[model samples]
Target: MTHVITYDIGTTGLKTCVFEITNQIQLIGSTTEGYDLKILENGGAEQDPNDWWNAMCLTTRRVLQENHLSPEDIQGISFCAQMQGLVLVDKHGEPIRKAMSYIDYRAKKEQKEGIGNGFKIGGANIVKLSKSLYITGAVSASVKDPVWKYKWVQQNEPENFHKVHKWLDVKEFLISKCTNKFVMTEDSAFATLLYDVRKGKKRFSREICQMFGVKMEHLPEIIRCTDMAGKLTEGAANELSLKEGVPVFGGGGDASLIGVGAGAVGPGSTHIYFGTSGWVSTVVKKRVLDINHMIASIIGANSGHFNYFAELETAGKCLEWVKDHLAMDESNLYLEKNQISEEKAVVYKNLYDYMMDAIAHVPAGSNGVIFTPWLHGNRCPFEDPNARGMFFNIGINSGKSDLIHAVLEGICYHFRWQLEAQEKKVNTSPVIRFVGGGALAPITCQILSNVLNRNIEVVEEPHNVGAVGAAVVTAVGLGLLSKIDDANQLIQVRDRYTPDPETKRTYDKYFPVFQSLYKNNKKAFEVLNSQ
Candidate 1:
């Protein structure tokens, strides 16, 4: 057996996991450290790179000590991180400014002037859109995309932009700190929508870069996800209480590897992830694009494959917002009560559990209430930064339980929307793997099953799927496994949920209204939020 450490870097926190990889992937120890994501005025989201490094150091020491293992025992290290973040680093690999979070949309003006204005189709300049699609199978159409972030910095923070030595994603920045090597895995490179996806041309496209006014020099060397980036350096080793020269694999973004952790690497294999953000992805043999719906196939960690992907900017984040605002009383219970036992004496661990327990008996459809889960805006099926979440059709009879249940159902409704959009182009697996922090709740699993009317499979340690996927990449890099496809044999499902026809009927009744909510309120959203 080989021991490895995988860091799953998320928007709000970092999760570190130690795994024993053999024929099966066993999680031995783990830790999570959170950092703040500063939400600036005008849709700017940022995080300090130093905060991430500190969290890594703190979690690394704790997990290693708790597991009674030394750094030398860890055969390799890897990362699966949030994608599309823009981290501009200087010659010394230090960040020139605060890293732009994936949700940052301050590039509205840049997007407008760059691509949103002029002769356009689907809100993008037709000429540029066609070129981008021809080369990359995607377009930098959203204000939140990395190229626009780079442009935002160039026009607004010209001094910082001049000092940038290379552009890196969240995982690439961490990889640089660990190994003193500046590189981006294929998956991260492709997310920029600047890389050429044509056969025998897996490199960054000079034409797309020039069209977008991006300096190719700022981009880092591209490497496959299964390649070794470099060895952990002495400075990083000392900070994390580890040995130097430990191989650091070129890990991928959550989009590419989370599905791998769910054993959804094969073509047509689908998985749904609900975390701070959520997405529906299916492995496909070739690239696919649906410009109308804003869904496209992105390069995955596996060679010659793409992930047909759709995203929801905020998924479990809506739950977080509910816990903060709507569930104030329940939040107090969370602090006052550490654990609660029921007839089964099941110890409730987190506030979500208590919240789920409180709403477990609430019927499907939230009793005629519908909710839109666009708290931070949306991506797939539509691209509207002005869109905001709301609880619709709430009557005087509606209770807190109804609203809370509606939030969960609202997210599931969006998932179904994305799933159907994907199905329009390609077939998806019937037994979809559900993995993420949200999947820990059985109620959520069942609600998702009912809403989508498909079997929902949950693996052990659903929250750590990203970390496990990173470990699988490391194992392949270290030659412990023959290929990534071996993950299907290692990660097994712990539970499978079948849809309840009666519950499905209730959800089916409301799903149409949920779909119409966006179209009905879009004008109102733009009018109110166009600031």
Candidate 2:
């Protein structure tokens, strides 16, 4: 068996995992380290690169020590990280400024000037949008897309922008730190919306760069996800207590790899991920863009494959908010570091478990209440930064449990909407794999299955699926695996959920109402949130 290390760089923290690759992939040890996401008052979300590095070093050491393994035991390393982040670096691979997160929407001014003005369709300039669609099969119309972030920095922070030698996404920055080689994976490159996706042209589009006022030279060399970037350098090696010559592969973004990890690498394979953010993605043979719905096909880790992705900005985050506010007393039972009494601890292992139990007693349809899961704005089927979450149709009879259940149902309802939009363009897998931290709850699995009226399969270690995808990349790079599709043989599904006829009927009734909530409130949202 060959051993490899993979990093899942999430929004709130970094997770490092050690995997044994043989006939199957086995997670040996895992560790996580948290960091701060600096939320600026002006809708800016940034993170210090140093914090990511520190978290990486800490987690690497802890996972290695806990597994009783040494540096020599690790054969390869790769990453699966959040995509569309703006990480500008200097010539020496140092960050020019705090990395702008995918959640950052401070680029509104830049977005308006770039694509939102003039004759428009779907809130974007018609001529520019048409060109973008024809060239890249996607458009950077969202205020949070990386192109706008790049322009935001160029116009607002000229000094830092001038110092930048290369532009990178989150994983590419870490790869540069490890290998001292400036490179980006194909998937990361495509997220920029500046990459040409034509059959014979798979490079950065000079035309698009010029159109957006971005320097073409700032883009780095793009490599396939399975290719080795370079060997780890002495500095990165010493910092992580690993060997200097360990091969580092070109890992991909979560959208690309999480599906690969879940055995959804083949065309038409579908997966739904509910994490801090959520997405409905399906592997497809050709690139596709639904400008009307804000869904697009993005480059995948596997060659010639693309993931038709539709995302919701806040998924489990809505649950986080509900736990903290609507269920404050219950959240204190397990979420806080404070010691829980033995009696209470025996009843519930964590806040999620407590919530699942509480909501299990609440009937489907959230007792006639519908909640929108757009706490931090929304994307997909509708691109409205002004949208906010609300508990609709709440009567005096509605209680805290009903509202909490509505939050979970709301997230599921949104995923179903994204899936329906995708079905309009391409065929998605009948039985979808459900992976992410949210899948740990059985109630969530059932609710999702019922809401979508499809089979939901949960694999072992659902939360680590992204790391598993990264491991598959490293294994392919090391020649332990012949291709990415072999990952299907390695991952084992832990549970299967099918829609309950009675529950499906209840959810079916509320799903239409949930869909109407956004359309009905669009004007109200814009009016109330106009800044």
After TM-score superposition, the amount by which residue 186's alpha carbon in candidate 1 deviates from its true location, in angstroms, is 0.4
**Per-residue lDDT over 318-345 for candidate 1, one digit per residue giving the tens place of the 0 to 100 score:** 9999877877655566654433446335
Error of 1 at 489 (Å): 0.8
Candidate 2 local lDDT, residue 202: 94
lDDT scores of the candidates, listed in order: 0.92, 0.91
> TM-score for each prediction?
0.97, 0.96
* Candidate 1, lDDT over the whole model: 0.92
Clashing pairs in 1: none
Cα-based lDDT at residue 280, candidate 1 = 97
Question: Least lDDT summed over 10 consecutive residues: which range in candidate 2?
Answer: 331-340
Candidate 1 ranges beyond 4 A from true positions:
330-346
**CA shift at 115, candidate 1, in angstroms?**
1.3
| Model 2: lDDT to the true structure | 0.91
Q: After superposition, how far is residue 178 of candidate 1 from its true place, in Å?
A: 1.1
- Looking at model 2, residue 147 earns an lDDT score of 94
lDDT of 1 at 334: 67
